[model samples]
Target: MANHVSSEKRARQTEVRRLRNRANMSAMKTTVKKVLEAVQKKDFSNIDALLRDAQSVIAKTRQKGSIHKNNMARRISRLNAFVNKARNAQ
Candidate 1:
């Protein structure tokens, strides 16, 4: 338990930030999954758009401090590479 008033307020703030970060992470994961699924299904038509959406979500997540900038860059890079490979294979 938080003993001091300041500690209690800090705890509350932490909880709120945790929830916000969780939501951002969830959204980022969902967008990434959507892009992967589209690729797996060989749905090239919408893959680019999905990749853009995933990149946007990921960048936003990083901006929100839910993920590190390097992590964000790596994810976007891998996703882009996968999409490119799939397109090339087609």
Candidate 2:
């Protein structure tokens, strides 16, 4: 429990930030999943668009501080590699 008034306010702020981060993370995961699934299925028709969207989501999440810049770069790199491999295979 937070006894001090400032401490109580900080606790509330923490909770709000937690929830917001959770939602952003969930959304980012979903976008990444969609891109991966498309790659796995060899669906190249809209893969570029999907990849672009996923990259945007990751960038936005990083901008919001929900994820680190390096983490975002790693994910985008992996996703690009997957797409490239799939394209070559097809």
Candidate 3:
């Protein structure tokens, strides 16, 4: 329905951006799940490395405007809490 040339171009760009953002969000969620799974299994040996990878994913997702920086911070906060608790349970 975008009749104007500008609008048509914008619509195309928006679709591409939407797909990219969705992929970024999905990747973030998957990485977060991987970290949580490590914690859930009470395996902290590899958690530090997993946390580092997750941090990178979070930062990139935030930088790309896919998710709010504060939301990412909150996620990291909860993830670390779980990690620490799991580690201390020993």
Candidate 4:
């Protein structure tokens, strides 16, 4: 669909970036899920570790431009709040 050379190059770059962004987002989601599961199971021993991993992944995703800074902050905040609430409930 990209007839011109520059357009073709742009299209190729877009595709590559799309794939990279998708991978980053997927990784971030998986990390978050792991943390939530640990919390849900009341596995306090590893929850902190999992939360830290999730936060790290989220920050990386934001740094990669896969997600906005505010979005990253919101996600980390919500995850932290959830974990803290569960922890305090114990």
Best by TM-score: 4
How would you encode candidate 1's per-residue C-alpha lDDT over 1-90 as one tens digit per residue?
A: 999999999999999999999999999999999999998999888887899999999999999999999999999999999999989999
Q: Which candidate do you rate higher for lDDT, 2 or 4? A: 4
- Per-model TM-score, in order, reads 0.96, 0.95, 0.91, 0.96
Candidate 3 lDDT at 46 equals 89
For all predictions, the C-alpha RMSD in Å is 0.7, 0.8, 1.1, 0.7
Which stretches of candidate 3 lie above 4 Å from their native place? none
Tens-digit lDDT track of model 2 for 43-88: 8899889999999999999999999899999999998998898898
lDDT for position 68 in model 3: 93
* TM-score of structure candidate 3: 0.91
Best by lDDT: 4
Model 3: pairs clashing at backbone N, Cα or C within 3 Å: none
- Clashing pairs for predicted structure model 1, backbone only: none
Shift in Å, residue 57, candidate 3: 0.5
Per-residue CA lDDT of model 4 for 1-90, tens digit only, reads 999999999999999999999999999999999998898888999887899999999999999999999999999999999999999999
Query: All candidates' lDDT scores?
Result: 0.95, 0.94, 0.91, 0.96
